[model samples]
Target: MAEKLGTKLNFVQKDLIKKSTKEPGRVFTVKEVANSYGISENTARA
Candidate 1:
């Protein structure tokens, strides 16, 4: 579905997943992700 629409995980999303995998027990909030990526909090939540 997303692929058909040409939608995919962005760099920030990929990096967040990689970091989480590399460090167990790590947690990230939508606000933190948004700040780190310079995106809006709502966008991070989505």
Candidate 2:
């Protein structure tokens, strides 16, 4: 069996953080984030 290590933030989370920092004050909705990342709105909200 293999052991799995958890990460504090996945790629998407890290990317979101980077974007927010660079653009400061910009608001991101679940739908916008989902569309940008090509993920579902439900997943983005999660």
Candidate 3:
């Protein structure tokens, strides 16, 4: 369905968004990754 629309997103990207939108199990805290690795939150999320 997505491929028919000409979207460049692959299966993994689409799957992640669908799963997140459906349940959103965790808060998706980019800050956590940044703090753990000593990187900026924006970079971590990106």
Candidate 4:
């Protein structure tokens, strides 16, 4: 994966990263992340 562009991370982004490491090879989607983290799809997309 490419280096994260942003220096600071939102809660969702941070958790997503943590989840990714725990579940390597699993793919994530905007909708799935948003629903799991209680954020909106737009937030996840950004």
Scored by CA lDDT, what does every candidate get?
0.82, 0.87, 0.63, 0.83
Per-candidate TM equals 0.73, 0.77, 0.39, 0.71
Supply the TM-score for candidate 1: 0.73
Evaluation by TM-score, superior candidate among 1 and 2? 2
Q: Count the backbone clashes (under 3 Å) in each candidate.
A: 0, 0, 0, 0
Error of 1 at 43 (Å): 0.4
Clashing pairs in 4: none
Clashing pairs in 1: none
Quality of model 4 by C-alpha lDDT: 0.83
TM-score, model 2 to reference: 0.77
In the order shown, the candidates' Cα RMSDs to the true structure are 3.4, 4.5, 5.7, 4.7
Q: What is candidate 2's CA lDDT for residue 41? A: 94
Best-to-worst TM-score order: 2, 1, 4, 3
Model 4: ten consecutive residues of lowest lDDT: 1-10
lDDT of 3: 0.63
Error of 2 at 28 (Å): 0.4
- Rank the models by lDDT, top first: 2, 4, 1, 3
1-46 per-residue lDDT for model 2 (tens digits): 6554335677888898889999999999999999999999999998
Whole-structure CA lDDT of model 1: 0.82
Question: Which parts of model 4 are misplaced by more than 4 Å?
Answer: 1-7
Q: Which prediction has the highest TM-score against the true structure?
A: 2
Candidate 4, residues 1-46, lDDT tens digits: the string is 6767565787777888889899999999888988888889998889
